[model samples]
Target: MMVNDKSIVWILKIYLLIIFVFIFMPIITSVVFSFNSDRFPSLPLGHFTWNWYDKVYYDSETWDAIRTSIIVALSASVLATIIGFCTAYTDFRYSFRFKNAYLALALLPPTIPLIILALAMLAWFSKLGISGQIWALIIAHTVLGAPFAMAIIRLRLQQMDKDLESAAWNLGASEWATMRHVIIPFALPSIISALCLTMAVSFDEFAIAWFVSGLNKSVPVVILEILQGNVDPQINAIGSFVFATTMTLVVIAQLFLFTKKPNNH
Candidate 1:
């Protein structure tokens, strides 16, 4: 039985390794090709060089897209996190009629098809006379990212002790005081995690941005433009940078999420 278990463990490890390789091989290839001196990716990679990276760095259009993406991501993530915290707190603190329906609506955006969501946002923003503006992209991204933030914060809130708030109230704390002193501190890690995760989501998003971002293009939109024009080596370099940035944010969020102290109660 011991030998069988060891063999099974080895099999699982190998399977997991294979899965990771399948998922990451394309990204690894893009990173490797970004450093290659060759204009086109092929079997025999050209000499290792920084030419592609330099070109992407010096391109004004690339910088503009990156700046726009940063602004939109930062704005959207803040809005999303704020909205998420409020909705999560409501769910955590109260019970009302059609509460399940409220939760369903709160979490529904992410489940909808991105293209459909994008089209709907475009129509709505156009009616509001905000389409094709930076604010439009910000609003659309906020909508897309809010559900993710809510899910993350809600999970963390679920782990909290229900009686902590009651104890605070009993000790002469007002409702707002209990929230400020106890709940926020307890969920701070997850809140930060949600912020990072939502920022990453907004940074990487393309479809909605493409629809609403008339002149103000984000990084992903720029990438698509590059692809549409030609097979440029600069794309590999830019993709590598975007992937690195997004992965960093995801890693930071995951670290905060999983490193929280377990609830004793």
Candidate 2:
């Protein structure tokens, strides 16, 4: 038994190490390549420089794309977060018919192939005369992101105690007052998580944005365009910046959630 247990432990450890390396190898390679001084990706390793980073920062087109992406991400995240909060709150706080079906539908977007949805949206948009506009992209992104936000908020709401709301109501507080004063406070972390996740999704979204964004260019669309013509260190530089930004935001959000002062009402 002891030998079998030892073998199993070793196997699990090896498996975990392999999985970790497999997942991170591309990321590590990309980060390393971002600092490569050579114009070509295959250039030998000791040529490190800051030129690519400078180019990434200084290029007007790249900056424009980045600005566009940020605007779309912020808009879509805020819209999706609000829609998701309302959806989750309704499902949890009230009894309704077809609630299961509603939740299943909410989760369907992430499960379905993105290509199919993008194509469908493209067809619909073509008929509506608004195909390829920023509003089109915003609507697509909101639909894509709201489901995920709802699911996360629902999970967090489940973990929350309902007595707090009930107590607030019992104190002669109105429903709106209880929600504003009590429910929203407790759900802040989940709200922040949903916002972060939605922003990330909107920021990196490619397929739907490609279809619905029309002639307007976003960072991902610009990145795709850049890739079609040439392979440059700029790709790695942009990726490195995205990676760094994502990591920093995730760290800050986690720390804020975990270290926040508890609400003692």
Candidate 3:
């Protein structure tokens, strides 16, 4: 008996469609519910209203969370990118004792579960008496984002041509000057993409922020606190907005930074 290829294709298409819907079911529900005039998330669909968006805009706590998230993400991503690029550049340029071990340790954080890392950071910071400080949250998130950033930038660094650095040095450029002109320029794409990834990770990270944030909280922690007080559609609206924003940033990074080939100058 001959297999019907058209039927198989149709079946696979339907299967994929089902999977997509299943995955996005909650997100779709939230988007639809965000415009819901009624207080409850699900049930009879009510008349469309912008009240939730307006509420989010007017809510001081929501604004505070937004401000905190922005500051933390910016500071953390920049620091992570700088640190990651430097580490990757160093590891790539020169051989040292325990190089493999150092790379392994640097890459370990992304493998560790966030909850475990969060607890560890909380304990460490508590011992240092910095557990409740904003700096503590910033440091934890920087560490959390560094592995991913380093891994990305490291890949670019590995692919780089070593002759460029030699040429710069031959032209009488100092090590730092050569890096500024040659290495960093060649690796800018990867660095930018890594920074974007770090920003998104730091913005969305709840576990570490929650444990170390204490009174000062990022957006996710703030949202959790709001939920504990009441079941509000405003929270859903805020969440959906955040989801959209993060997705946009990821998509932009993928399209503009990752897809394009970096100039190897």
Score every model by TM-score. 0.96, 0.91, 0.92
Each prediction's RMSD over C-alphas, in Å, is 2.1, 2.4, 2.2
In terms of TM-score, which candidate is strongest?
Answer: 1
Which digits, one per residue and each the tens of the lDDT, describe model 1 over residues 134-183? 99999999999998999999999999999999999999999999989999
Please write out the lDDT profile of model 3 over residues 1-265, one tens digit for every residue.
1368888988999999999999999988988998999998768899999999999999998898888888889999999988898789879899999999998998889889889999999999999999888889889989988888888888888887889899999999999899899898888888888888888998888988999998778999988998999999988888898888778767755764665575544
Question: Each prediction's Cα lDDT score?
Answer: 0.94, 0.83, 0.87
Decoy 2 TM-score against native: 0.91
For residue 107, what is the lDDT in candidate 3?
Answer: 84
Best by lDDT: 1
Tell me the TM-score of model 1: 0.96
**Total clashing pairs in model 2:** 2
* Model 2 lowest lDDT segment of ten: 253-262
**Steric clashes per prediction:** 0, 2, 0
Tens digits of lDDT, candidate 2, 173-197: 9999999988888777878888888
Model 3 worst lDDT window (10 residues): 256-265
